[model samples]
Target: MELSTLKDAFDRASKKQKVSSSKVQEVIDQVGREIESAILKLQSVDSDQKSIFIDLRNKLVEISPMSQLEGSQKDLHIGLSKYARILEKHFNPDISKAYRNVDFDSHTVNQIIATHLYRHGLSDLGDFFMHESKEPSVIANAALKLQFLEMYKILDAMRSRNLEPALNWAATHRDQLLQNGSKLELKLQQLQFVEILQKQDKKQALAYVRGHLAPIASIHKVEIQKLMTCLLWAGRFDQSPYADELLSETHWDKIIEELTQQYCSLLGHSYESPLSVAVAAGFQGLPTLLKMASVVMAAKKQEWQEMKQLPMPLDLGREFQFHSSFVCPVLREQGNKENPPMLMPCGHVLSKQSILKLSKSSSRAFKCPYCPLESFVTQCRELHF
Candidate 1:
């Protein structure tokens, strides 16, 4: 039945002597429970309960006039207003689409607008009512459009706090906006910015920064700070003035050390066998003092070949001695003591068969099966296979 007609009938029934007020209250309570139950069901990942909840809430509001006693009329009106807002906040878009061609009575339109504004805020109504005032039809259309926007904007804003609700909404509603042009416009701007940056036109880059900051600076302080940092990092601005304020002494020291080490490593030999041997021997063999010495030596030599080549599990199988960098013939699963083998960084083992295959696969470069590291069999190749 139409909401208006249903409400009219209930209003008349409440005033009739034949219908008890208790029975009217019973129906209202039952419908309210149904509305809540539908809401909970809609929270699930696979629910299609929007229509059910809307129907129940509509019935509840329609019966409110008949069910509300003398002392509860104000409370009942407030409850109806809350229901309208909840439905507009959550289910209005679907309701609008479903009844797109149908004419709405004033009471239904008023309920939908009140609900949408109460739940979604009023910012969204401006676009839909650009050509019309707050008349019933205009308000209904605006409210529907606002609901559609809120459905996405609200969920997007909530993503950092709770991901599941947004994920479920996207899964269900993304297809409906497949032809939407909003994302396409955003992508175009990103592409244009990347192209301009690639051209290395400093004049154009500054202009772009100015354009963005003019509008965004007042609205987003954190974003403005990040933008300025990026400009400084790219050498577009003088960073010396803010260096002490932005970076700690420890951070500056670490940065200098890292850059110096990298410069040295790139200039010198690729690997250091002695350093690898010391590390592979075990923590006892490569004490903190020795490790520090190795770090200094590698920095001086500008190399890291030895450190990168060391096996992931240096103390594999207690069979090999400290000086040896060869594979063992035994294979053992984790937690097994007998014939124990060590797992490599690549997740492959140095089993007798596996080691043999690796040795023969490439003369210069072969990657481990479990991890991607260039490796070659140096010693004990003949003993393994």
Candidate 2:
């Protein structure tokens, strides 16, 4: 089923819930006000018409009944239940097989999840899970935890306009960061210099520029010139010619994110945790796969589980594109070690198996299916990606 279908059901259920609650609340409030007004009237009425109190109580009973509220609640519950059933009908609960099919120790899975949670500051949840699972107090990758902890502390300090922690870290890891093609140190130093200039400390700012900005001047000459100009209008940096040099809330956030990405890259950890990446990719791909699964079930083909190749490409954006892509045009299958991609003379590519089959395994050159050029199997070069 399409997600839109399920979403429509959910929206309808939510609307029903909100409307029911609103009506119930209105009904209760109006009845309460009416009863209160009646009691007030009873207190002022003469004793000769003491029967007015009894009449007001009877009138209250007529205007408000507990059964009406119960009925509305029951109807709302029934509507929500219907939507739940519809949602459940489309839900596929067999997704565990994808992870289960991978040959990894289950205990290792629990450890990774617990460690990731702990690393993200969900200490209570992580500790509870670790204890319940009879895991050791410390994770096997305790060093990685300490590394992430130190990095997060620097990030937290950066949020408070303190770049010293990050500056110190960058200085310590200068060689490794440079080797990884990172300019994080220069970026951090530049920010610190800007922060100092914003304080109108002309002498101190120039000193900082000489010490920190001079070395990286060649690489970031234009950027440095812009920041140096901020020194001229130090008291009014916000209205300076290089107004962009003024740090923004969003700019600070970007720095933190970029630093984390670079830090993870240097340490060979994924920019995002492995579990987060996998879960995100799975969610992005699941709807299409689930629809395919439903179609396969309807046709009694079971193609979703048995098929070796998916029919379409997954456009998961640039962040997910870690390496070059070389899915063969002819076979519509991704290149693998055994059936690697072959770059033909015409610049068209195909899997090794597809080329062999298309060529009919003949000795003579065969026509290129995509173009006018013809090439023999021996002429096709293996492509790396």
Candidate 3:
């Protein structure tokens, strides 16, 4: 099911849960009130079991709602169970056919996950995992940049509405941030200016703007003007035209995200964990891979690893796409540096080996498979990405 459908199912389940809980509480309260009334009557009158039983029987109608509560609770349970099953069915794809036996270095995989954890500031857990794995070559410090981890810690603080860490970082790396053309530092300062203004300290806020924000005024003239305009709102920035800029928490989120990305870039690390990126790409192509595996198994003539390239393309979105690739149709081979793709005179492309073979070792002019144009071996040009 789609995301919206899944959300709708969850909503229905939540509603059912609430209804059941309320009904159960209502029944309990009713029973409590009746029991209290019966106890009071017994204390006022004769303390006999017969008398208590008679009183309870007279007020028994109050407890009749218990049956309705039971029915409602049962129906809600059934509905919630059905909803859970639907969600499970929607998420679980048929993967039995996609299973393949391949040798994996479990140790290396563990190291990658552990390293990923370390990168994300889960050092205690990473240390535990590393020690448990007991691999001498897989020290966390080997791949880690101390500064990068520190930067991540700062970003984490920024996410928690603590900007001091980020401010200190920006101050220390001012030149580097400017070198990278990062707006994050300025954005953080702007947020601080707004925060100071939020406290109704316009004087300090103005002083901060002039002292801190003015230096970047050349690069952010329009933004500085907007901030200056926002000063008129004073303690009521929420009612200002720049309310979206001043009152929203998402700006902090954006700043933190950009800060992390820029920090990684400055430290020569990827913005995302390599293992996470790989796993995401794998999931994106999993269904297609499963189908391909099934087709190969059914045919019983080929193995997936035997192919020069995949029969179909795997679209793992723009983030995963890094470079260009070309496969030669004539030779049924992928273009490589040694045997690079070449363009024919007729606008057709093939690998160098394919051109040679099609042209009878370049003794004769090679006719394009796609057209009637022919070209000499010397005429073909190598293609580059």
Please give the TM-score that candidate 1 achieves against the real structure.
0.17
- The lDDT-based order of candidates, best leading, equals 3, 2, 1
Residue-by-residue lDDT tens digits, candidate 1, 290-371 = 3333455456663333343332233344533423334454333222233234344444556545554565753555666556
What is the Å distance of residue 254 in model 1 from its true position? Answer: 1.2
Q: Candidate 2 — which residues are off by over 4 angstroms?
A: 1-3, 22-34, 37-41, 61-64, 92-102, 106-142, 283-325, 337-347, 352-366, 375-385
Show pairs that collide, candidate 2.
none
Best candidate according to lDDT: 3
* Reference-based TM-score of each model: 0.17, 0.76, 0.61
Off by over 4 Å in 3: 1-110, 137-149, 304-308, 325-385
In angstroms, give how far residue 41 of model 1 lies from its true place. Answer: 99
lDDT of 2 by residue, 1-385 (tens): 5779888988988988898888788778877887787767767746434676677678668866576688778889998999988877777676543331347887888887876785676766776887798877764456666777788789889988899999888888877878788878887887887788778898999899888777668877887777677788886778865566446777678878988987787777777777888778888777556656566445776545566666555567776776656777877777788888889999998889988987887577888888999999999999874
Ten consecutive residues with minimal summed lDDT in candidate 2?
Answer: 94-103
Using alpha carbons, what is the TM-score of model 3? 0.61
Q: Tens-digit lDDT track for model 3 on 1-385?
A: 2778888888998998898888888888888888897778678755786878787877777468768787988889888898888866565567665555668898878877877887788877877877788866443455573565687778777767678898887878888988887877778888888889899988888898898876678888988888888789898888988879656878767787888888778777788998999889888878677767667545766776556666677777888866556788977777888899998778888899988888886658878888888899988999998
lDDT of 1: 0.44
lDDT of 2 at 13: 87
For model 3, what is the alpha-carbon lDDT of residue 381? Answer: 96
